[model samples]
Target: MRTTHAHPIAAALAGLALLATLSGCAGSTAARSDAAAGGPAAPVPAAAGAAAADEKAASTSEGTAYAAPGASERQLARTAKLTLVIPDPAKAAKELRGVAEGLGGYLLNENVVTEQKDGYYVEPSTVTVAVPGTKLDDALDALSKIGEVRNRNVGSVDVTTDMVDLEARIASLRASIARVQGLMDKAGTITEIAQVEKELTSRQSELESMLSKQKALAGRVAMAPVTVTLRPPSVVIQDPNPLWQGLTAGWAGLLQSLRMLLTIAGALLPFVVLGVLIWLPIRVWRRRRRPNAPGLLASVLAPATVDAEDVPAAKPLDAPRDRPTTVDG
Candidate 1:
């Protein structure tokens, strides 16, 4: 019975050793799916979104180029500042309002100031609007009719590199996060689970931050700003100097000088006090160690000396030594 049991135990041990050797030779099966291990790379989803946007933009430009023969309509994405001077403010305003409404563009901001000049009227206006890239030309054409078009300028910035780089970074982070999630699901040990959770949290935060950056960039590219400044045909004159202007200016100067003085004092007072405090200790030490003057010396040293009248009379030492002392029985 002992021999039979030993044989079974030895067989089981041999089987376990063989299995471990096979597993060691095979290495990890997980590496088959990992791109770093000679595997095919995974598709980047965020990159696809950016690529689609570029394709759409290209298609849009082509469509606009072939819209009509001898058509001046162009698809442009840029920021512009326009200044217009018209004879009729109300009429121009009404006409531009219809054009803006028809273009699907709305006024983001508007300001109008009306004044009387030489018993006449003058209106100065400012409006900030955003229009679609496809309808920019139409919007600008309609707005130019409102005034003399003093300034028709546009500024553009190319963010292609920035946007593409951001997309790539976002995609990489998302891939890393997915891998971490898988690891978290498979992790059985407490240490491994904790590590995966920490990594996932970091990746999630980074992705959110990158996403915000992407949105801000997209908003900037999608909507172009057009600043329209409208002024009256004629100039308005005003008094060069008001009555209370000089007085107010003088008062302001006085207050400014007072503040300057106060600031200087605030900055210098600590150094001044520190210098005084430092000088005080040196002055005390010098006084303590100073050489005495004639009067001061006399006053300080006179008590240590005794006058001849206050001294006790001294016996003659030579006479006492000359006489030998006899021994007493």
Candidate 2:
């Protein structure tokens, strides 16, 4: 009986050892297969694997967000001002309008001013046009062909940052509005609904304003404004004689002096007339108060002359002295 019991216990121990060996072999085979397939040689922990995946995803997103924009992605608003000297400004202005229309542009404004210059009517035109940004150069070239370019100025403003900021704000506002809408749907009380509605209205209004700004900015970026000033060729006075020029200049100076003198005289005439009116009345009153007094004209002339009867006779110096000495004796 003791031998049978010992034999059964030994068989049970051998079976347990064989099962352990099989499980170890299975694990080793799995590891080898994973390695052969370019996977981890050892089993990774689930938490560690998940953390690494999250880190990689975050890095990718960050890189994407901060990547530098290419040249085509840049937003620029361009404007140009040109002053052209042409033979006929009115004709040039009309031609410029056609050119603008041909190049996918429209005339924004046009003003024609007719003025008399040097005894001739001169028509100067100012035209403002909006053209596609891509065609700005072409439009300028066309303008150059129309007349002599006296002045040309081209300017650009980079608006990429502004555009990006607008887009981000719009996205944020939309998300916020969506969240508010979800809250509205779930709101249970009247007060909650009212508050949610108010917030929604405010956000919607803000969104509309933002959208309007975006539209304006985008329009500026897409279209380039060009201002063209068309002026007739300057009139050249071609008098070859220096003497004539001097005489003309002297005559002009004389006329200008006369005009200045007239202006000054005109300005002083009123005050002079007022002073005369006041002084005449005062002088008349003083004369009327003292009628016996010498006339003012006579009083003023009295000091300048002497009457013949009032003058004393002069005696000869030698004769007069001898007579006085005899009489005293």
Candidate 3:
């Protein structure tokens, strides 16, 4: 200890200063790290978790909201008026009604009229029925047995888009309303509460409207209307007295034709007489204006050129060729 050399005070002061500077730099680095951890711009782990949860909830809600209406919409169905023609209308009507009943349907309207042939036989009758849309094919099959199906028409309209969209909107609005109600309950401030309440009211109104539209769509999809027309079966009637009937018809037709012809002739008689009266004067005038026949010589007279050529033509031709100035040939 007696032999150790003492350090200079200035040197000791410089060493202490350097140590203090290094310490200050380390402290500043630690403060900067702590500040970065608690800074306003830094990502908050709790906030990130909450944001992820909110996003998941929104995605789920939207998925539920936009879902389409189910199978009924996918399975579009419709029926159109079908017409059948048969020879005998009355029998066809009965058969059509039976077919309708057989096909799980009912006759909505029935009309049959037996037009008589010479007030003797039933001509035909017609029947109309209302059948279920699903049973239309069955009804048609059964009707085919009764008579021929002359016409068939099927039609459908698309309302699925509207129905599906409305249903989705309804679900979404309901979910949103519920969410808003939850917010309203948790909201402490009056301003937030009021805003949530307003949003809830609007959503509720939209929900009601969507529900109304859904009901209307449901009604349309539930029942389908089918129209069926029945024609009578063809019936051939043979009369033993066909000859008599034919003769009677022929006589009647002949009489009718003669009567018509006479009537037409009588109708045209006045016009024919008037036409004759108009033509008489014109004929007389034409006849009067005709010239009397002339003498045979005058009637057969030749043209001036031919006559001039034929009369001493040799001498005239020679003179014209020689003396053009004397006369015009």
Model 1 agreement with the true structure over 1-329: per-residue lDDT tens digits: 44433433333223322322332222232222223311122222444435434543453353333221122322234787889986655676666667777788776777766566664555577778887655677778888977798889878776655555555455445544555554454455555556657766876797788667766666666667778888776665666676588888999999999999999999999999999999999988987787566578888877677799999999767654476779999
Question: Which prediction has more favorable lDDT, 1 or 2?
Answer: 2
Q: Rank the candidates by lDDT, best first.
A: 2, 1, 3
Clash total of candidate 3:
5
lDDT at residue 70 of model 2 (Cα atoms): 34
Show where candidate 1 strays beyond 4 Å: 1-77, 87-97, 115-123, 236-329
Q: What digit string (tens of lDDT, one per residue) describes model 3 on residues 15-79? A: 32233233323334423432343234322244433443474366446544334355374634455
State candidate 1's TM-score.
0.47
Cα lDDT of model 2 by residue, 67-147, tens digit: 323335988889999999877667888999999999999999999766767755466789999999989999999988999
**Runs of candidate 3 exceeding 4 Å displacement:** 1-73, 86-134, 143-147, 183-202, 218-222, 230-329
Model 1 global lDDT (CA atoms, 0 to 1): 0.60
